[model samples]
Target: MRAEVDRFRRGAALAALLGEWSTGPGPLYRKLADALSRVAEEGALEVGERLPSERELARSLAVSRSTVVAAYDELRARDVLDRRRGSGTRVNGRNRGPRGDGRVRGGQGTAIFQRLIDGPGPAISLACAADEAAVEVGQVMREVVAKDLDELLSEPGYHPHGLPALRQAIAERYTRFGLPTTADEVLVTTGAHQALGLLSQVYLRPGATVVTESPSWSPCLDIFREAGVSLVAVPLDEEGIDPNGLAAALAEHEPALLYVMPSFHNPAGVLMSSARRRAVAELASRHGVAVVEDNAYAGQNLSPTASLPAPLGAYAEAGSETLTLESFKGIWGGLRIGWIRGPVGIIERCARRKALADLGSPVFEQAVAARLVPRMEEIGERQVVSRRQQCALLERLLADRLAGWTWRRPDGGSSLWVRLPDGASADVFAQLALRHGVEVIPGSTMDPSGAHDDHLRIPFARPRREVEELVDRLALAWTELRRHGPREETPIRPIV
Candidate 1:
C-alpha cells in the first residue's frame, strides 16, 4: 500500500513537471522522452525514484499507452531510465546523487516562471493580465533621482516599514478613498504578491482554515496553501462573493481569515456592490474573522462615469480589516511596489515579517513610486481608456470567430471569465490552444475545488494585433477540439 501511494505521488509530480511538453516540436514520443530527460537533468526528481508504469503515466498524460511505451523504450536505450518486469521503471542510478531536500518543487506556477524568464517563445500568451508601464513612470523616476538621489545614497537604505514618504503617500491615497489612514498604519512590500505572503505568514498557521472566493486569484491561493493553511472556497456571482455562502463558511469553519477582492475581481471581473460590501463587512465582523480586502484593482474602473465604492475597509470595523493595494493595475507590473493598510498593530506585525523576508523593497523604486502615487488618477485615466478599447475588440473578435462561447462584459479588470460551449473541457482546450500557438488560463487553475473545468479566463490586455492573432489561433484550437472529443481531465495548473 505504501509503495502504491508513492507511485501515485510520483505520477502526479511528473505530470506537473512535464507541463505543456506536448506543445514543443517533435513527435509525441520524442517530446515525452525529452521532457522526462530534462526534468531528470534539472534535479527535479530523485536519482533512484521509481516511475509510474507506462499505462498509468499514459492515462495521466492523456496519451495512448503505446506512446508511453515508446518513450520509455527510448529512455531505456539511452540509459537514462531503467525498467524491470516487476520493479517498474526508475531513473538510472548513474545520473547523479539523490535530492535529499524532500521538497515538492515543480508545479504549473514554476513552469510559467521558467517560460517568462526564458523570454517569449512562439506562442501568443493570454495568461498574464499585466500591461506596459504608465508613460509618466519614466519622467517621475528621473525627477526622483534628480531631487533625492544624493540624500538617499547617503542613508543606510534599509527601511523594513517602508520609506517614510512612500508610506505617507499610500496613507494619503487611502484617506482620499474615504478610509482615513495614517503612515503608521501602512507597511510596504515588494508588491501585492509579497504583501499577501506576509499576511499569510503572520496570521495563519498550519492546519488553519481560510475562506476566500471560489475563483480567486491563483497566485494568492498559492501563497496561502504554501503557508500550510487549508482553504474553504465561497462561491461568487455577478455581484461578487455570495454573502450567504460567506456567512455559512464563516459559521461552519470558523476560519482564521477571509480574503476577498471586492473591487474588481481578478478572473470574474465583477465589481461588488456597495450593499454587498457592507454585508461582507458586517458578517466578518460579527463572526470575528480577520478580513483581507485586496483592492489591487481599485482604480481600474473602465466606465468613465462610474462612482466606485470605497474600499471594503471603509465599511468594516476599524481594526478588523486590512486592505492591500498595488501599482500593478493602476501603474505598471514592473514597478513592484505595494502596501498594506490596517491597524497599527497588524501593520507592525506584517512589517516584522517583511523585514525577515527582504529587509526592504528597493529604495530607488519606492522613491519613484512615492512621486507616482499622487499622479495615479492621471495615469489611470489613460489605462482605463486603453483597457476599454482592448476589451471591446476582444469581445467582437470572440463573437465573430468563436460562436456560442459566452462571457459577461466585465465592469473592470483586464480578463474575461468565459464559459466554454456545452461539453467542452477547459483543461483539454487549454492544451489544444497551446499546441496551436496561443496560451490561456483554464478556470480550474483559479478554483481550489477544481469544479469549474468548463470555464476559461481570457485576458484582453495585449496589443491589438496580438489580440487578433490570439483569436485566430483560438478559433483553430476550438475547431480541432470539436473534431476530437474531450479526453480525460488533466491536472489543474497555476498561472499568473
Candidate 2:
C-alpha cells in the first residue's frame, strides 16, 4: 500500500503547479477534504494508495497532526478515502472519474469554480487585484471634476485623443518621470489591457516571434496569441528573468516583441535589477526589437534603492525605439485608464487603429484618471504597509508550520513565490484543496498552456485570519492526500 501511494505521489507530482485563491477560508480538516477531492478530479493521485503517515503529512503540509487526522477523517466519512488501524491509509481503489460537466470540482467550497460556473450570491470576490479608492484615488477624482467642469459644460462630448486637458496632464507626468513626453507621443486608451491588446494588434504581425518570462499572466498570453505571435519563454530565477537565457533567446529568435515586467512581476514578485534591466534594454536596442515594457506596477515599488537606472525605453532606444505599455491599473485598477507611450510614428498608427476600434476612450473616466496618476504615491502607503504585514504573516506561518517548503521574500509586492519540496504538485494540490473548501490557483493560472506547474503564487489581499485559514487548510490537504486509502463510506456532505 505504501509503494502504491509513493507511485501515485510520483505520478501526480505535477500538482505543484496549481495555486489557490480562497479555495475557501475555513477549518483545517474541511479544507483538506476539499483539496483531496480536487486531486482525485485532476487524476494526479489515485485509488488504493497509501498516503504519508499523519505526523509526516502534517509536518510537510505545514499543519497540526490533528488537522491531517481530521481531513482524512472527513474524506473517510465520504467513502472517498479509507484508513485502517494498522495498515495505514489508502485510496478506495474504487471507480473515480472527473465529475460530469467539465467544471472544476468542489462546489461552494472554492471560488474560482463558482465564478467559472456562474454561481450566484457571491458579491465580495477575492479573485484578483487589491487597489481601492484611497486618498490618492479620491483626491484625484475631486481634482479631475474641478479641473474639467467648465469643459464638461461647454464642449461637445468625445475627442479622439481624449480631453485635451487630460492628454496634456499625462504628457507632463512622463516628462517628470525622466521620459521626454508630448501629447502626441501618447495614445490614451480605455485601460492597460486594451493598450497591450492594441499594441499587439498594431506592432505584431502574424507568426512573429515574441519572448516573455515563464509563469506569466494568462490574459497577456491571450493577447499575444491573438496577434498570432509565436511565444518563446525564458526561465525565471530569483532576480526576475535569467538575463543569460533571455540574451540567448534574443540571439536565436530576434523576437519582434520582448514583453517585460521589470518592477513587481505578476504571480512571481521577482523584480529586475537595474543593471540587468539596462542590459536587456541594450539588447533590444541592438536587435531593433520593440520592448513592450509593461510598467504597470512600477509606480508602486517606491523601494529605497541605492541606484536605479532609467526606464527600459530610455536604455533600449537612444532616441525612440522602445514601445511601452503604461497603465493606471496598478495604481488604481478601478480607474480603467491607460496610455501607449511609443515613437510618434507608431503612436499615430495605433491611434488610427484605435479610432476604428473604439473612437478614443471614454472622456469622463480619462478625465478623472488624469488627476489620480499624479498622487499615486500618496495612496499606496497604506496598501503597502497592510500587504507587507500580511506577507510577513504568511512567511511566518510557512516557516513555523511547513518544514519542507522554501520561498524568497519579495522586496515590495503583495505575494511571495514558494517552491515546495520536490515531488509536490501545486497544481494537483490546488485541485485537491477544493475538496477541503479552499480555492487555489496553481502555477498553471499564470501560464496559458499549463507550462508552469512548479511555482505557486499566494496573493495576500485578504484579511490575516483568512490567509492563516488557507495555510492551515492547505497543510492538512497536502499531508492527508499522501496518506492511506479511502474507507468504504461517503465522505463529502452537501452544504446547507
Candidate 3:
C-alpha cells in the first residue's frame, strides 16, 4: 500500500510539471512525450524514479488511458522512459538516446564535443565559435615558405621550448600589450588547449581545488576536471567576474590556482573591466593564488576604435601570473599555434611537459605564426567588420522570428550568450533544433553547477548565409515550444 501511495504522489507531481503540455501543436501523445522528456532531461524527474502507471497518470492528468499509454510508448521508443512488465515504468537514469548514428548521446559535455567532432551532419552548426583563417595567414605562409622553408626542413625541428623566432615574436607582442615578457617566459604548445593542459599537469595535483568563473569555457573546466581538481565557481556579471565573490571564494577555498578568461570571455562574451582586473590581481596576490589568464580572445575587439584594458597579468604580482595566448581568435584556429607566458620556472616546467606530450608544435606553423603575430591588428580589423555585420544580422533575425529570446550584445567575441524564454530548457530545445537542422551549444555544458541550462551559446562567427539558416531553424524550434503555451510552474525542489 505504501509503495502504491508513493507512485501516486510521483504521478501527481509529474502531472503538475506537464501542465498545458497537451495544448501544443503536436498530437496529444507526442506533446506529453516531449514534456516528459524535457522534464527528465532538466532533472525534475530523478533517475530511476518510478512513474505512475498509465491508468493512474491518466486519472491525474484527466486524460484518456489510451493517451497516457501512447505517451509512455513514445517515450520508451526514444529511450527516455523505461518500462518492465513487473517493475512498472521509470525514468531512465542513463537516458542514452540514439543520435541517428551508431553512437549514443553520453553526458552533456561529451555530447557537445562529439557533435562538434562529427560536424553538423545535415544541420548547420553554431557550436564552434572559431572562424576560418584570415587572408593574411595564406599570405604569411607563402612568405615563410619562400623565405625560410629550406633552413627549417634541414633542422631537426625539435624545440619543445618552441622555435626561437616565434617565441621572441610572442614575447614582443606581450611586451607591446603592457605585460613585460621575454622569450624565456613563453612556452609554445600545439594550441591554447595544450597550454592549459601543460599548466594543469605542472601545477595541479589530484584533489586540489581550483577557483574559476562560473559559466567558464567548457573545455577549460574539462581540462581542470581531468586533472582531478575540484572546481569552485564564482559568478560573473556584465563587467566580468565579481571581485567580492572572488575574494569570498578565495578565502573559503584557499585554492592552488585561479583560472580566468578576462578578455572576451567564452560564452559570456563580457570583457573584465580594468578596475576589476586590478582587484582580481590584488586578491590573487594577497591569497598567494597562482593565476592563469586566458587571453585567447583578447585582440578580437568588435569595435575597431575600442581601447581595451591591459591584460590581468599587467596588474598581477611578478611571477604570480601565467598568460595563455593562441592564434585561433586572431589569425586562425587551423594554425594550431598557442603559447604560455609566465615566470621562467613555470615556463621551463611547462616546456618539459610539452616535450613529453608531442615533442613540439609543428615548425612550419610556428614559422607562419611568427610572421602573422605582427599582422594580427590588421587581420583583426577585418574580422571585426565581418563579425559585427554577422552579429547585427543574428540580432535582427532573432528579434523578428524568435521574439522572446534575448542576449547582451557581446563586447567582442564570436558568440552570443542567449537566454531562452522562461520555463524553456535549452537541453530540450537543442535536441529539437538539431532535428530542425541546426546545432547549438547549451549553457549547461559550460556551467559547472548547471544553473545556466535555460541559456544557449549562439555563435555568429559563421558567414552571413549560414547565420540566416541557423536563426531560421532556431526560430522553428522556438515556435514549436511557444505553441505549447507557458509551462505551468512547479514547486521548487529543495537542493540536496
Candidate 4:
C-alpha cells in the first residue's frame, strides 16, 4: 500500500522536522541540497509543492541566500523543482493541491511513523517547559472584578498596544531592573510568543538574516523561519555565545536581528555572562544589528548560588535597537501575559503589528498581570524552592539510571540540556520514549541547522511527584531501548 506524500508549504516547519538528518561533515549548500532531494524523494516534500523563496529558506536554514540559491539550482538541475516565470518555483511534478489549509501532511518517511504515534495511550509530556500556575496567581486572578470588567468593557476592550496600566507596570519593572524604561517603550502582548512573532513580522523581511544561539527556544526558530528570515546560529559555551564566534557571524552575515536569551536560556540553561553581554551589545551596535533579549526565565533562578546579571538593554548605548521581551509564564504559566520594552519607535511598529494579529491580549489578563507584577518576587521565592527540588530529583534519577548521560547544571531555567552517550541519537531515543509512556523533545528541534541530534531537553519544572514517576518510566524506556537498540526507520517529526 502506498501512502500519500506530505508537501511542505512552510520551509521553517519542514526544516525543523528534518533535524540533523541533513547535517553532515561537508559544504553546507551541498548538505542542504542533498537534504531537500532526500526528503522529496522520500515523499516528505511532495513534488509540485512550492518551495519557500531562496531568501526565505536560506534564513530558516541559517545559511546564506547563495547557499539556498545554489541548493535550488542543484535541485532544478536534478529536475526536482519547476521554475517558470510568473508561477514561482514549485516541485517538479503533481502536488496534492494548492497549499491553502496550512497543514503539513506526511507519509512513510516523516519523523512520526504510525507505529510510534499510535502508542499505548496518554504518555507523559516533558515537551512543555512551563509549570502549573503558582498559588498566588489564583489570588491575583480573584482580585479582578465586575467593576474592572465594566471599566475595560466600556471602551471596546481593544488596546492593540496593550492596556496602559499593564504597560506601565511592565515599564516600572524594567526601570527597577535598572533599564530605566518608560511606559511608552513597552508593548504588551498575549505572551512572549506573540511578542516575538510581532517583532518578526514587523522587522524581518524575506531572506534577511537573524542570529540566534544554537539550541535556542524551538518556537522562536519557527517564528523567524516563517517570517522568511535566515537564522544564523552561533554555538554557546558556559558563559553563552562565544564572542569571537559572534563577531565572525556578525561580520559575515550582518543579521537584521540578534535574538538572545542571556538570562536562563531555554534548553541550554546557561546565563550569558555580564562581560559577554557587553561584548554582544557593542558588537550588535557596531554591526547595526537589532537585538531581542528574551528574558522569559530571568526571574526563575532556582540555583542556590546563582547571581542575576543586568538586562542586556543596560549595555546598549543610547538609541541602539535593543528590545527586551519578558513573559509572566515563568512566574505563572496560565497568566498569558508578556511585554516588550524597547525604543518608542520599535514599540510603535510592533504595536501596529500586534493590532493586526489579535487586536490585543485579553483586557482581563492584562489587568491581572498588572496586579501580579508587583508581587512577582514573592511568587519567585516559592517557585525557586519547588523547582529546585524537582530539578535535583530529575538529575539524581538520571545519574542513577542513565549512567552515561551528562548535563551542565543549569543556573536557573526549566530544562536541562542533556547529552546522550556517543552514538545515541536523541531523535531515536525520543521516539522510543514515547512508546514507553513518556514524551521528550529531541534537542535537534531547537537548532536551526538541525545539528544537535545527540542531545535532549528534559524540563524539570513539572510537579515533583509527576516528574519522579515520569523519570521512572523514562528509565525503563531507556533500558528497553538499550536492549533493542535505536530503530533506524523512525522519521523525525518536527515539533510545532
Q: Which candidate comes out best when scored by TM-score?
A: 1
- The regions of model 1 sitting more than 4 angstroms off are 1-16, 45-65, 72-104, 485-496
Tens digits of lDDT, candidate 3, 377-453: 77777778888888888889888988788899999888888998785777556655655676656676677666687
- Give one digit per residue, the lDDT tens place, for model 4 in 1-496: 0212223444444663443433235566666777777666655555656677876665444445777777777778777778878656776653223443333334212332222343333667665677777887777767677347677667878889888998888888878878898899999998888889888887899999999998787767877877777889999999988889899999999899999999988878898899999999999999988999998888788765566788999999877999999888777767778899999998999998888878989999899888888887667766788888888999998898888999999888888889998757666676557556775677767788777878888888766787778878888878867775532222222457
Give residue 396's error in model 4 in angstroms.
0.9
Q: Where in model 4 is the C-alpha error above 4 Å? A: 1-121, 304-307, 486-496
Note the Cα lDDT for every prediction shown.
Answer: 0.79, 0.66, 0.77, 0.76
CA displacement after TM-score superposition, residue 176 of candidate 3 (Å): 1.4
lDDT of 1 by residue, 1-496 (tens): 2223353343433665565677865677778888888777667755667788877776545466777788888888778888867877878756543565333354334444555555677887665777777789889889987999998999999999999999999899889989898999999889888888888987899999999998887778878878778889999998889999999999999999999998789888889999999999999999999888887887787887787788888898765755555655567888898888888888899998889888999999999989988878777776788889989999999999999999999888888889998957676677667778876666766777766778888888878998899999999989977876323323222456
- Which residue pairs collide, candidate 4? 48-91, 59-229, 59-230, 59-231, 111-491, 111-492, 111-493
**Candidate 3 local distance difference test against the native:** 0.77
Error of 3 at 185 (Å): 0.6
By lDDT, is 2 or 4 better? 4
| TM-score against truth, every candidate | 0.89, 0.72, 0.79, 0.77
Worst 10 residues of 3 by lDDT: 485-494
Candidate 3 off by > 4 Å: 1-108, 485-496
RMSDs, each prediction?
5.4, 9.5, 8.3, 10.1
Find the number of clashing residue pairs for candidate 3: 0
Candidates arranged by TM-score, highest first: 1, 3, 4, 2
What are the per-residue Cα lDDT tens digits for candidate 2 across 463-490? 7777787788767766765673221122
